[model samples]
Target: MKNKALYTLLIILVQSLHTTALNAQRSTPTEQINPYRIVERCTLHGISLLNNLDTYLSGYNYTGAGYYFNHENLRNAHTGNYNWKYLTTFSATLGYTKQQSNSQFTLLASRYWSGYHPFRVSNRLQLWTGAQIQLAGGALYVPANGNNMVSVKMRTALAATGIAIYRLPVRQHTIDLRYRIDIPLAGIMFSPEFGQSYYEIFGLGNTHGVIKFAHPLNSPSWQHTLSADIPIGNNTLRIAYTANLYQSKVNSLRTHIYNHSFAIGFAKTIYKIKRKDSMKAYSPLL
Candidate 1:
């Protein structure tokens, strides 16, 4: 009887230990999962020097100073994705130019959406190649010309874009040096034929040759941006120089718009937290 009781006690003790072990394992926490997305947003303001020439409106080059505004948002393509990112940007400019006694006022705006795949070259350098779709519209108005005082601009293009970022350690912080470029491949644009007036196209309903297909051969355009991000206290200060060259020869008419600008901006990063349902659905086995 004593031996039987001892055996039963041992079995009971073993079962207790097993239950304790399982309880401890269940109580231990799993590795924390990140439930937030990081996003970068920036806004910039600057002064642009504009040079414009449109054979439909004027034969002389018009040049002047303009105000420029730019806004951008950048984020990863998806949760837990480090190889790809997405960016969206909007920019606008307003200015005027004069040649002799003729004055031309211009307004321009463009929006771009892009996706990039990053190639890490080193610990300090990264190269990103991307593609973008751009939508642009603007108008140039000259008061001196009658019946054809306004030249409207509208275009959409698919562009090849690239960015290079280099990190430089300075004291206790790092400064990012970046360069970006964009070249349009092909798209469509709205243009009136040579010697065609808006009255003839809109009022008189002569709409032929108003919409044209564009390619590198007919509309060769590119943009360049060089920028630096400097950390200041709790904020990042961005200083940039941007140059845009746009040219097109279509419908027997020639047009070009060139702008160079120095810009100042602030960049900030924010985290977007997952919702309660998302958090619950992401539970993992411990």
Candidate 2:
């Protein structure tokens, strides 16, 4: 009887321990199972049609061909919301234009960072609204002018941005159609006064009226992007068209830079795993 009682106690202990282990496994957090972050990177090359007019350089509108390179990164925000994402973009452009014997060149570089929150409109459509901060600087070179050959451009702005995405299924593949637009709300810009030479502003230390407040009335700008992402094999190809219209009137000088570009790019998704979580884990379905 004593031997039977001991055996029964052992069996009960073993069963209790097994039950506890199973319960712990079932209660494990979802994040521990999916310990990786996903990031999408894209690089694009494009040709641009540029229309530039800078009264500081000349009274004529300079029109010509240009080229641009764009790189972007997108990732889910760390706020634990799957519908929120962060986007960063960097772009550079070089343009060349000519008028009667005068040739002009423009070099521009810009960076944008945005945080977007998405609202599902339907099973296949989503609308994202966001705010963007933009930093842009450039210089226009006119070799014909002796003293005032370079017109500098620098600005920073807070913008309201929105994006619409639609998913279309064709046969066995899906295509994502996206449209994005950005409008600057308020900002500050650097501009020299009309007929003011760089020498007076920099060399002579006459710094008055160089920095100006920008608003829609003084500096109206818009950026529009239309793109389609098509899945091919294991990769995604993006074809895009972008229109950028920038204009500012400050210090009695009027300036505008317009560009229309067509771009082709590829996007790749990367999974980032921490060293501690090097082992494979079960990923949740989307």
Which candidate gets the maximum TM-score versus the true structure? 2
- True-structure RMSD for candidate 2: 12.4
Candidate 1 Cα misplacement greater than 4 A, ranges? 1-36, 79-82, 274-286
- For model 2, the stretches where C-alpha displacement exceeds 4 angstroms are 1-36, 80-83, 275-286
| lDDT (Cα, tens digit) per residue for candidate 2, span 1-286 | 9999999999999989877865665466335433227889999999888989999888889999899888999887656545587989888889998766889998988899999998999999999999999999999999989989999999999999999999999998899999999898999999999899999999999989998888889999999989999999999999989888899988778999998888899999986766444332322221
Ten contiguous residues minimizing lDDT sum, candidate 2: 277-286
Evaluate residue 88 in candidate 1 and report its C-alpha lDDT on the 0 to 100 scale: 94
List lDDT for all candidates, in order: 0.89, 0.87
Q: How close is each model in CA RMSD to the real structure?
A: 14.0, 12.4
My TM-score estimates for the predictions, one after another, are 0.82, 0.83
